[model samples]
Target: MLFEDKYEIIRKIGSGSTSDVFLVRDRKLKKRWAAKIIGIYSGGGTDCRVKQDAAREIQILTQLDTPGAVKIIDVFEDSRRICILTDYIHGISLLAYIHKYGPVFEQTAAKWLLQLCGTLDYLHNMMPPVIFCDLKPENIMLKDDGKLTLIDFGAAYQQHSDVSPGIWKGTIGYAAPELCHGTAVPDIRADIYGLGVLGYFLISGLEPKQVEKLKDYSGHRIVSRKLDRILSGCLSENPGKRYKNCEHMAVRLRQFLRKADF
Candidate 1:
């Protein structure tokens, strides 16, 4: 189908519960775009809610103009689907890269972490502070130019003034422990915990549980002790014990990079 009077659907690329993404080409502009088609349901039901959520993701992404974030060009809705057109990214997802390359080198991982830290800090320091509920490697992509872009803002939300307890939104392995309790609100600290999990996976080639299973290492013998310590601190089960915010975490990571000559 036609979208925005320019983008013509070539084929489906990817999909999620809320939307289906298609690879499209702009006939007039002669550019490629990933068009996310969200289903629209009437009668104010679950489908309607899904559309709302999809729209919210687009809204949140549009507001974030950071280099580390994906670039969205426009959004459109027909009777069947709500389409979000974004710049086509040409690189493998971080998850695919790790599986293929078998974890990243120390310096490479540090560089990636720093980029993500900067991105998260930018999001957290905003007036409303965008909370990215999904921060796993699967949600991150490595551009062909070796740059990083945080994708899938479906779970992003702005902080509310009420400050009341709320249900958590994040993945299991990478999600903060406080989130599992269902009483915590999404905040910058949650991102810190997720980053820690990401660090462990990227540097040690092991997940948090695997790192735990390495009881033989005594926590101090792991490769890159400095990095391990940072990851362990960031992945703390206690939210209060994690980094105060993305800014603090970035500072620590920056220091480590400089010391390690990354």
Candidate 2:
């Protein structure tokens, strides 16, 4: 209900299947925060599994120390609900920013994706290896300082062992083909696919799925032919045909920057 025994709920920012996100402020601390509350599921609302899942998500978020990753400040549970307190990222999300400014400058776009890739690298290489199941632009925030912060760990999962089956959950447009089959488990590469899809959107302003059906992208102003090739490669139908990994993709993206004198 109350945070740090001071901040009160101002209003709800967003809500999902199992939780409600509120924008709160602490007068004593003189800071803003995003608070996520989890409670019992009524009509497929919340349940024990969701509570346990929220706990796991908090644990994963707490381990992050990267700049572009959203910081988790505190976690607590009361008789009424499970609560997670996180820094209120100031500024709009990447999706909103892009919508307002058409496509971001190529250099700025590279900077954003690089920051995200750095965070993804950190996440994928954790001791137990953590996979950010969801990696869409909506989940990526752009701070006032021109830095990108990754948010929403509701779909995040830990890699138990090398042989463990991959999780099959992610947003449809961003989800990899294997996840769609619900048989083959996804891996870190799946995140790459999502990033690839993001790259496609940045260069072409068209989603990967839409690109497949369309004939050409030459009409796009900001993106050049060479850049389009790279985007297409990243969005390859077969994951195997795409970049080897985030590190590899980052390397190639850097090459693009260098060519552009970035």
Q: What is the C-alpha RMSD of each candidate to the true structure, in Å?
A: 3.0, 3.0
Judge candidate 1 at residue 48 and give its lDDT. Answer: 62
> What is the total number of backbone clashes in candidate 1?
0
Q: Distance (Å) between predicted and true CA of 106, model 1?
A: 1.8
Model 1 RMSD in angstroms: 3.0
Mind giving the per-residue lDDT tens digits that candidate 2 earns over 1-262? 3554767778898777767989987767777899888775556554766666777788888888888787898776865577888888888887777677776666666766777788888888997778886777778888888788887888777777322344444677877776665655666777887886776566545655675633355653556665656556666667788777678878867888889883
lDDT per residue as tens, model 1, 145-197: 99999877877777763334544446778877777676787788888888988
Give lDDT per model, in order: 0.78, 0.73
Model 1 residue 223 CA deviation in Å: 3.4
Q: Distance from true position, residue 250, model 2, in Å? A: 0.8
* Least accurate 10 contiguous residues by lDDT in model 2: 161-170
